[model samples]
Target chain A: MSDEKRYLKLHLIVLALVVIAELIGTKSYKLGPGTIVLLPMLYALLLGLLTGPKFLKIIDKEDMNAAEGLITVSVMLLMAKYGTNIGPTLPLIIKSGPALILQEFGNLGTVLLGMPFALLLGLRREAIGATFSIAREPNLAIISDMYGLDSPEGRGVMGVYVAGTVFGSIFFGLFAGFAATALPLHPYALAMASGVGSASMMSAAVGALVEIFPNMAEEITALGAASNLATGADGVYMSIFMALPMCEWLYRKLIRDRAEEVIKG
Target chain B: MKLSLKDPVVITVIVAILTLVGNFVGYKIDPITAFPGMLILFLIVIVGMWITKIMPGNLPAVVYVSLLGIILTMPWFPLGEKVAELTSQVNFLALTTPILGYAGISLGKDLDSFKKNGLRIVVVAIFVFVGTYLGSAVIAHTVLKLTGQI
Candidate 1:
């Protein structure tokens, strides 16, 4: 009856609708594991787009923010669940240290492999900061502090950060699922691959693995969670001490030729 | 009657209820078992959030919750096995459905920003994924081969 209550009711209704849409989308399709991994996300995005700015007209801003804030709870629950799953496998995870280390290398590889293309695309120097860093929530803070948020490098990183936040999970989920099923690699390796720091991406990646290898889901989830935790803890230092400088060097090398071309023209 | 959804207390209560309902419906576990499992999860998250808030460095809530979960459910800890058994029925994958759904909606809000970044951003993201996947894969492959895991 009260305004607050009314707004809350409307928000719940909208959320129910979104969830129903996702359910229908997922249930109606008989897509492969990769597509199924992404179906809910795709449906949510499509519903959000279709509903668009108009939904804003109905839902109050504060209430909308509140709804978004609830996402943290979901993430926390998912992490807790993941952590519980990892408990029994603690010994195994410790023994798999080499694989975990390799996963970190792979995480660093994103910057190594992404920067050249970023530079070739004429992203400018600042983007190197963004491209080189893993671009998760923590790295964003480190980058912002080291090179003020307004700096081009800051903006570049922010762009990728946003892109990663938005698409990272979807991409990782689809890729991990596809890789686990199609590649010759071990599922555990793919599981380690899932822990690229961002929780959503990790969840999506691990979820895809579950769909593909149901029997190995528990081990896979546990390994992925461990790898992700390691990335989060060690990744901060790696980004600051190693990735930033490495990316900068690669960016200059890649961009210098383009700069010379511009001068000659 | 005048409870604001923005209130943390309100949100917490709502989340606890939703998580319970979600576990029940999705996992199809009996209420007695499900309630305790959900309660443990809820407490873990709350404590994890508190720890993150008080911790010196910028520890993410995910890390805290995960660490807490691991510790509480460790084989050495009292009630570890029991909690693990109950929590395992919580249906983590079911929980992921709504989380990913919310992530999608959140992504939708950023479509314009993404569009502004151009196709280049997509290329960079792809490379980010490739670098991560390949970097991990190459190392993992070597390690597994050496250890005879494959």
Candidate 2:
């Protein structure tokens, strides 16, 4: 009947189709592929397309909230199962963690890179505000509400976080690669090498290594297999654990109430 | 609709059962394959939201889809042989959120604006980066050194 209603129906139809596909695929072929398409990257693109530049503006008008129960529960479940692996995974985590943390700092570096430019652009308020504000990540939409990135200053802080996350990956990945070569360690270096490359990059590296050293391919794959799985899950965990919460806490203290007032006025 | 954890839990249980059966009935079909298959199923469920237009855009669709996707795919329950298989396969690198987060953040449309404010953002990100890294490093090297782990 109404335009909005019609659009809603279309979205519903697409959802139904996806469900049906999953059911049939599982029952019949027992396989699932290309599911990576559902990553937050896709969502960010979608939000950008639908909401445009004002997207952050709209998100800012909302109250800071997060799925406190769900996130905490999910992470708890994950920790319970994966926590023990701490012994085996710890060394790797530490080696990678430093790089990861550096990447986070490197991200902050990117934010600073933008700071003076913001002032120069005469969008100082937005610049200053954006600097500390946690910019929205489309995937973060799920838990972002719980954290206070919804506030102006929060958004400003988020802007920094968002920037950091982006550069952090490349820096970390690159760092990992370099360290792997420079260091004498095996697993740690290999993992770092793998880290610098995205999934695809790792895949290529593995393929090339296997090709060049055919005898060692299986060994390399065996060593890498576990990390591959962890790579898939860890990113999600850190986002939920470290990134989103940090954004929320900062926003709540500095900008939450003020944002609501601004919105009301 | 009111949110409840019941559905996810139930789904997880059902998957556990299926994994067991599959391991028993079809010896060739490993949990790993089935794991991805489960992710595919989860993704499909979200497609319904998209079809109905209730799904706002790609991002929401992706988030809901992946959350459910990983749940379905991750081998929480293991059949006899697959039990050890899943355990050995689990590692830190398998946790894929950071790279995915990076990809998402890098897609920000406000890069130009962000670039303009470059100094502040970079400084903060660096400070945070150093803080987190150094803190963790100290804990690992100093705290865990005696354990011979780090």
Q: Model 1: clashing residue pairs? A: A106-B135, A106-B136, A126-A153, A130-A157
Give per-residue CA lDDT, model 2, range A146-224, as digits (tens). 3333333333545555554445434333433443345443432243234221343344334444444466567556433
Which stretches of model 2 miss by more than 4 angstroms?
A1-141, A144-169, A177-228, A231-265, B1-144
Docking class of 1: acceptable
Worst 10 residues of 2 chain A by lDDT: A60-69
State which candidate has the highest TM-score. 1
**Prediction 1 TM-score vs. true:** 0.63
**What value does the lDDT take at residue A133 in candidate 1?**
57
Lowest summed-lDDT stretch of 10 residues in model 2 chain B? B93-102
TM-score, candidate 2, first chain? 0.35
Interface RMSD score of candidate 2: 11.4
